[model samples]
Target: MHPDGSIQAESNSSKADRALFNSSEARRARLLPSAEKKKRRMPRKGKGRREMAGSRHPLIEAVDPLAEIFYRPRTVTVMTVGLCLLAWFSDAFGLYGTKFSAENGVKRGLWALIGTFLAYSALYAPHTFMIRPHPIVWRIVHGVTILYMLFLVLVLFLDADQARHAFKYLYPDLGVALDERAYGNDCRVFTPENTSSRFANIMDTVLDEFVLAHLLGWVAKALIFRDWKILLFLSIGFELMELTFAHMLPNFNECWWDSWILDVLLCNNIGMLIGLFAIQRREKYGNEWVGVSSQPTILLKAKRLFLQFTPETVERYEWKMMSSPKRFIQCMTLAAACLACEVNAFFMKFVLWIPPRNMLNTYRLFVFFLMVIPAVNEYYYFVTKTGKEQVNKLGVFTWIFLSCTFLEFLIIFKFGRELFREPWPPLVKWSWMAAGASTTVALLIWTVSRRNKLKTQ
Candidate 1:
């Protein structure tokens, strides 16, 4: 009906409208795919909430992946290799002995100072570079450092005269008792007329120094455990241990009153109570330790400033509260291990004919304490996080344990001529040891079972 040109124009307009509609539909489809992609990539809020809920502890949140790597078995193996090489050279050649001469004492003192500084620097320097994963590890290391320092101070006191002489040469009127013979001479003051008095004095001294100190140590253990029942069990179990082993060591042979009253009731209980009080206080108030920058107010700022001036704060770790029963058990088990360790020190010195005051004995103790920190940390990690029952012990702990047992046997066989002269009746000693071990295990199991029952109720 219309002209040919008008028809063509109408057809072109229809085609253009259809093309635009197709393009709009394609755009809508493209946007739908993009929206779906976004939903898939984004994490759901509920999932995030669950992940956060899973790890509730602040300590767990603070763990560094790098620290976990550094603490791996391979790294520990390498460290063990290095320490072994050092031990071999030191023991075989007596490298340390050469530094102890009169002429070299001044040099030795200087070197000792430098060596100590370097050792501490090495310990602390790593912290600056790396974030410590385990707070307990830091605490253990710090505790070991304190023990080592205490041992060194005791040794210095033992050789007070030599130390004083050395100091006199360096500076006059130091007025320090380098060789006072306070402990050694007083300890050896034995007489026939004063036999009863001497024995009483020895009892008193042992009670005050060793027994009381250890009882207090147990109290510290209880504070760490934060449970009264476990504390009671540990206190009793340790006494039983002493009783069981009394025949092996003359030192453990004490009067009943001395064992029960002085050791258990007075020293042990007091220490445990003090530790308990400390724990309660800490739990109620919470720990107040803050980083240097975070300390508030002028007074707190001043306190932190003062702390920096001394070596007191150098190895300090941020204190944390432990809640898990697993953690509590781990701590107690480690403490038990430490008891064995302490006994090892005594046995090694006794069997080796090395006086307790000897430098070698002091050095060994210091070294052992230093080694225990890393060892215990590794042990705690393996047991707790890794779900491992048999944790790898640090070389130092293993060495100390083996050395103690071996030396004990060596002394019994070689030096204890009279003690072993009479052959034991069939199965007497072995039976006694077995009975003691069985009793210990039974008591521990009963105690744990009772506690669990109480908790459930």
Candidate 2:
């Protein structure tokens, strides 16, 4: 009143309300779990975050800050209703009518089936070892892989002509006989003009376009495998495979220099080196990852954002095949499976009359490339990783891979029976037997050595 601002006294109700609120908050804090309470007490950034992450399993990747959006609950009810409504409006009304042939009807049905399967996959596909690049990508991988497996199974049921016709329906240009000889007919015998024509041979081999494909394919394999020993085994194993199958599939027949030098030493080795070099760079520098959102510069953030699909980390692997008999068998099985995959690709092409130039061939290879990443990762963990982090069962991707592998073999054996009827060279048979005996001897030696080492210990 006297032009002076005096402080007001505290209201009793307000004082009581403040005290009550503080007491309630204290109660809530006390009721929390010890871990939760500790987490809440920790600083939001730096050491606290590092501790939390360090406590988690290594297989669990860093969750994107935006990952909550992707975790929203999904249901098939809406999708199912939409499908029914579309079918009712279109099919029930006989919009297309009987103008659709039986073949057209079947094709449409197949397309619908494939679409449904893919939708299910996107919504419900099982997770594998790979979760980065978005789980949706791995879902798509699963969908495509299972579809490929079914395709292989379907091929087994059909005769060669039937399979050819069906495949042509999809690709249109495939059903023609391809010249299987990769190095060409000139490699059959050494002539003065032929064997000496190194320049022409290199040009021919390089120009075939498959050489480039092989180079890129090996690069991908190296990255997926991330192990030089495994890559070397596959490279040499495939060469021996080519030798064994050369009598039947002429494409495997190549000049000694071409097989060992051009294909192996040049294309495969170069690609693998490039891939391994990339891995080295990533391991050396990219081992530490700053959050994409945490980057100070826009350009750096954008670069990190773009590279989100790349591997979270690149760590080299040591298969240690000879560590023990069990491990040796496992490693050999894995390598053999890889070799089988390569054989399946070639065998399917030859049997189904799909030429190497066909888009289907390219697509098949691309599928294999995508699939093997998760497959190998899963298999590695299954065999090696132990205790709580161990994968007790084969993962979805690995199962799909094995299923397709064996299914393709069955298909080849069933449809290509006539090819097998041809007399295989006696040398090829004896050589394979010798290889089996050698592997057996090697396993026994390892077993004996391990036993002796245990006794000494």
Number of backbone collisions per candidate, in order?
4, 0
Q: List the residue pairs that clash in candidate 2.
A: none
Off by over 4 Å in 2: 1-71, 74-99, 182-184, 187-198, 285-298
Model 2, backbone clash pairs (residues 3+ apart or across chains), number: 0
lDDT of 2 by residue, 226-314 (tens): 88888898999999998988877877878887788887898889999999998888787533455554567999778866666677556
Candidate that scores best on TM-score: 2
- Which regions in candidate 1 have their CA more than 4 angstroms from the true location? 1-212, 223-234, 285-298, 305-336, 356-378, 386-457
lDDT tens digits by residue: candidate 1, 1-457: 0110001112556445534422323323322346655465444586455433322222122212223332222434545665566455444477565444666555655544544444443333222101133323443444344444443444334332343344344345443322221222233335446756756545555646455446656665654445565556566766665665555555555556556766677777888788777655545522223334445577866674453332211121211214344554555565566566556555444433444445655566555544553454344334443322333433333343334434434443453454324554455578778976985786677678868988999
Query: Looking at candidate 2, what is the lDDT of residue 189?
Result: 33
lDDT of 1: 0.45
* Residue 59, candidate 1: alpha-carbon lDDT: 19
Q: Which ten residues in a row have the lowest lDDT in candidate 2?
A: 1-10
- TM-score for each predicted model, relative to the true structure: 0.44, 0.79
